[model samples]
Target: MRLAVLKERRPAETRVAATPETVKKYKALGLAVAVEAGAGLKAGVTDAAFAEAGAEVAPDAKAALDGADIVLKVRAPLAAGEGEVDELAMLPRGALLLGQLGTEHAGAFAERGVDAGSMELLPRITRAQSMDILSSQANLAGYRAVVEAAAAFDRGFPMLMTAAGTVPAANVFVMGAGVAGLQAIATARRLGGRVSATDVRPAAKEEIKSLGAAFIGHEDEESRAAQTAGGYAKPMSAAFLAKQAEVVADAIKKFDIVVCTALVQGRKAPTLVSQPMVESMKPGSVIVDLAADAGGNCAMTKPGEMVTTPNGVRVLGYTNWPGRIPAASSALYARNLLTFLTTFWDKEAGAPKLPPEDEIVRGVMLTRGGQVVHPSLQQQAKAA
Candidate 1:
């Protein structure tokens, strides 16, 4: 089987799907690895490094993908426009493409007879944890959010005592207690900041407290059922959101930094910080919204840009937080894809044999047999 790694075309996407370390592993698995000339350049991997790992370096995406059995990418294939060739058109029919291909692009891949496997749809089961791209990437996003917030704020993170005077530690509030939010709380605490967090899920309360952050959320029936079995947040009612907003509005006033990571699966991110809430915050305070790409958890957020409000609060809304630390992000993400491949590799077939009965395989496989066959996409098609 020939595995090809293509260059990322998204404007802010600096991370690549494969690294030299993973390319070597692919070769050992009896797969021919071909990478675009500058595929890993932004992620700190040079063409020489990939060549040293015994992989072929193609001149461009078209050459790299020609006759390839499997294609790995950081994002979904780009459509023709904005100085980019239509990557989907170049893919060979019946080839498997794997990455963060969202539901919106399912129809295009199906029409081309390309079997698409979305890393975002990897099941949350224990056996599939190593291949969980969302958790791996979101963990870095959470840590980076705190780092960015600290830099944006004028005050220091840790307290100081000297002959001159005593400086109090900064206060940080993390809105959401998922994988990303928990890492933010931990990072804030590591920086000597007093951290607090809030989440609608009941399980998140213990997770927050365990990380030495105070949990702040009103307990109710709706809050108890806010988490799905797959460990993702479910959408909350308007009434619950209003009550939760009141609690956040009161607590946010005392914090020097706010990290918003709340997200509801398949829906726009719930607004946790209102414009009035931003106005209420003290001058020099900073807010980092990790959910900015999904419409943001703060009304003041300007996706992909940082802005300061009229009231003097800075809102950091860069969408690709992991890409800011590209080297580490690429390394971890490459390992995730490599692990997924190894787990599904078939010794007899010399290729990935995706078992239909396997929950993880079934969850991630978006299109097969020239149709949109993933359970979720099938349901979405029916609904449409």
Candidate 2:
């Protein structure tokens, strides 16, 4: 079987799906790996590195994808009129496509007879931990958010005991306690900032405390059931959101740095930081909105850009935090793709064999056999 890796054409996307290390692993499994030239350049991997690792450095996407059985990507391929190259048109029929492709192109993939596996939809099962792309990418994003906040903030993070004067530690507040939010808390704490976090999920309280950060949230019956069976956050009711907002508004005024990572599965991110809240913050305060791509948890956020509030609060809404640290993100992401492929590989066939009855396969597979097979996507299509 042959595996193809193409350059990510999505704006602000610096991550590459396959790395030299993963290319070596695919070659060991008797699979031919073809990577487009310069595909890994943004992630610090050169064509020479891929070639040395036993991968064919194809001249372009067309060459890389030629007769490929499987295709790996950081994002979904661009459809006709979406980019300079119609990548979807170039895909070979019956190719197995895998990436963080959103549900937007499920019907197109089905029409083209391609099997599209959206890795972000992977089930949160113990056996699939290594293959979880969302967790791997979010972990890096969480760490990067704190780093960005520190750089944007005027004051230092740590409490400095100087001969001149004593500098108090910055108060960092993380809105959410999921994989990303928890990492933000830990990173902020490691940088000598006093961290606190909030979440709609009741269980996140223990997680926040474990990381030496204060937990702030209004927990009730609704909040207790805020987490889904798959470990994703559920959208809170309007009543619960109101109460949570009240608490957050009071707490955020004193926060020197705020990192917003709250997001509900398949829903717009709930606004945790209001415009009034931004006005309440002191001058030089920095807010990093990690959910910018999902409409942001801060009302002041402008996705893909940074804006300073009238009161001098800086709202950083730069999208694609994982892409900001492409080298590390690509390394982790490549391993995730490699792990998923190996788990479903058919040793005798020397190719992947996704069983129809397999939970992991069913969870990630969006389209197959000329149809959108995933129940969620089917419902989404019906609603649309």
Candidate 3:
């Protein structure tokens, strides 16, 4: 069996699926590895580095994917009209496709006769911790969000005393206390900022306080059940959201930096910061919206761009926060993919053997046998 790593064709995608470190591991599994030239360049891996790891470096996607039995990528392969090269069409039939392919591409993958495994759908179980790409990537994005916020803010993060005067610490407020939100709180605190965070989940209060950040949210009956069984945030009721917003609005006026990381799995991110709330904020404040790609938590946010309000408030809606720090992101992401593959490796066959009944395999497998087989996607299709 051969595994091919293709260069990401999605615009603004800087991370690659495979790194030289993982390439060598894949080879040890008795599977040949082929990497497209310059595939890992954005993530600081060179063709020579891959070659030194005992992998073949092909000049293009066509040559790399030729006769490949498995394909790894950062994003889904683009269709004929989506990119300069038709990566989807180039893939050999019956090949196993694995990546962060979004839910939108299920039909395409089914039609292509490719068995697709979307790492984003990896179950949040103890055994699958090492293979959870969402956790790994979001952890990086969370740390980067604070760094970007600090850079854009005109004031210092920590309070400093000099002979001239005292510089007060910036007030950082993080919305949501998930993996990304907690990391943002920790990063902000490390930068010497006074941080506070809120989450719909009742359990998040302790997590936020443990990180030395104040917790602020409206808690009630709805809040008690605000988490899904998979440990993801559940969408709150309109009444609950309104009350939560009121509390956040009051706190945000005094906040110098606001990091929005709230996201409901399989749904659009809930709006936490409205335009009126943005206007209430002081001049020269900054907001970093991590949920920009799935619509924004802030009304003023413009995905992939920064907007400055007339009052001098800066709203950053940068998409692909993980891609902003490609080197670190790719390293963690590649390890996640390697971990997943090795966990299900069949030594006798010298290839991966995913049992259909396995929880992890069933959780990530979106399509098989030329059909969208995942139960979640199947239900979604029926509703549509």
TM-score on alpha carbons, each prediction = 0.98, 0.98, 0.99
In candidate 2, what are the lDDT values of residues 220-332, reduced to their tens digit?
99988998888888887899989999998999999999999999888898888999999999999999999999999999999999999989999999999999999999999
For each candidate, how many residue pairs have backbone atoms clashing (under 3 Å)? 0, 0, 0
Across 42-119, the per-residue lDDT of candidate 1 in tens digits comes to 989999999999999999989999999999998999976745679999998999999988978888899999999999
Cα lDDT, all candidates? 0.92, 0.94, 0.93
What is the Cα-based lDDT of residue 74 in candidate 2? 90
Order of the predicted models by lDDT, top scorer first: 2, 3, 1
After superposition, the stretches of candidate 2 with alpha carbons farther than 4 Å from their true spots are 381-384
Kindly give the stretch of ten consecutive residues in candidate 3 with the minimal lDDT sum: 233-242
